[model samples]
Target: MNKNEDSVKNSEFGFGESNDAYAKYFFGQSYLKRLASNSDEKINVSNVSFEPGCRNNWHEHSIAQILIAVAGEGWYQAEGQVAQKMLPGDVVIVPAHTKHWHGADKDSWFAHLAIMVGDAKTDWYESVDEAEYEKLN
Candidate 1:
C-alpha cells in the first residue's frame, strides 16, 4: 500500500461504535487510526484521523493536552463557546479539565498527533449540540 494508505490504516485504535447519542452515527468518509498506544511512551499518544463530520464527544483531561494537526483541516470547540477552524501546522493546547470537542470539518479530512499526559483522567460530557456546532460552520 502507499504511504498515505498505510497511515490511514495505522490510525485506527480503540475507537469503535459511538454509544453516545451525539456520536457520529455514520462512518461515511471519516477515518481514524491509532498509530501509537500508551505502551510506546510515558504518556498516551494517539494519531487520529477524522473524515468530514467525525468528532469526539465533549470531554476534558485531568492534565493538559497538546494537539498538532499533521494533515488536512479540522476544528476544536470548547464548552460554552464556538469552534475554531484548524489547518495544517496548527497547534492547540487544551488546559487541564477544560471541556471541549474537536474533529474534521464536514467537508474535509483531518488528522492530528494527539498527546496526553500520563496518569490523567478524561471526563466525558454531553455532545456538542447541533445548533452550537452549526455556528462554527
Candidate 2:
C-alpha cells in the first residue's frame, strides 16, 4: 500500500499492546501507555487505545479528566446526555464528579491522550450495556 493507502486502511487500527492492570475498569479491549505520570504529580498524561466496540465503564473523577482524540472515531457521553461523537482534534473536558463513559465506535478503533489532573482518582460505576451504547450509533 502507498503511504496514503496505509494511513486510510489503518485509521481504525489501534497501536500498542493490551493494557492489563486496569482491564477490570473497562469493557472490551483497551491499552494504555503512560507518558508523563507520577503518583505525586498534580497532572499526568497517558495514551489510551480502544478496540472497535470497546469502552470504559461509567466513572467519575475526583478532580478533572481531559480527553484529546488522536485517531479514528469514538463516543463520549455524560450521564443523562446524548453521546457525542469524537474525532481527531476533538477535546472533551470532564469536570470533577461528573459521570461519563468513552470508547471506540462499533467499527473503528479509537485512541486518545488523556490528561489527568488534581487527585487523579476515579470512582467507577456499572458497565455501559451493549444496547444502551448501540443507541448512540
Candidate 3:
C-alpha cells in the first residue's frame, strides 16, 4: 500500500453544494462547509467558497467574526469604506455589529476559513446593488 495515498486522493477542497437557506442574501453562487457549528464549543468555524462575481449581502455579527483567506482572491468591505482586496494568507477581523460584505472578485474563485468567536449571530441585510457593484474598481 502507498503511504502517500491519503494525500494523493482527489478531494473537493473548496467547491461544494450551495447553501440554499440564505440564497436570498447572495448574488451568483456560494458554497458552505461547516467545520464546527456547536455553540457549546464556544467557537464555530466554516469553510466558504465564492464563485466569480458572487458575494453575500451586507451583514453584521453580534459578537465578532474572523475570516482567514485560504484560496484565490476576493474583496472585503465595511459600510462606508472602500473595498479591500483579499488574497491568500490575508486575515480580516470584523468587529461586532459592523456592517460588511465579502466575496470573490469578478474573475476569481475565492475561499476562506471563517471563525466566529462568542455566540455571534449573523445579521444579514440587503443585497449589493449591481449598478454600485459595477462601479467598484
Candidate 3: which pairs clash?
A: none
Model 3 vs. true fold: TM: 0.84
C-alpha lDDT score of every prediction, in listed order: 0.67, 0.81, 0.78
Candidate 1 to native Cα RMSD, angstroms: 5.4
Write candidate 2's Cα lDDT for 1-137 as tens digits: 32122332344433556778879988888887777767776778877888778899999988888999888788999999989999878999998999999998887777888898677678899999889888777
Model number with the top lDDT? 2
Candidate 1 ranges beyond 4 A from true positions = 1-32, 37-41
Q: What is the lDDT of candidate 1?
A: 0.67
TM-score of each: 0.72, 0.86, 0.84
Global Cα lDDT for candidate 2: 0.81
Model 3, 9-96: lDDT tens per residue?
Answer: 2124444578687788899888887877777868888878877788999999898889988777788999999988888789999989
lDDT of 1 by residue, 1-137 (tens): 32233333443343323223334532333444445556545576766676666677788888899898776677887787667888867999999989988887766666777887667877787666676666566
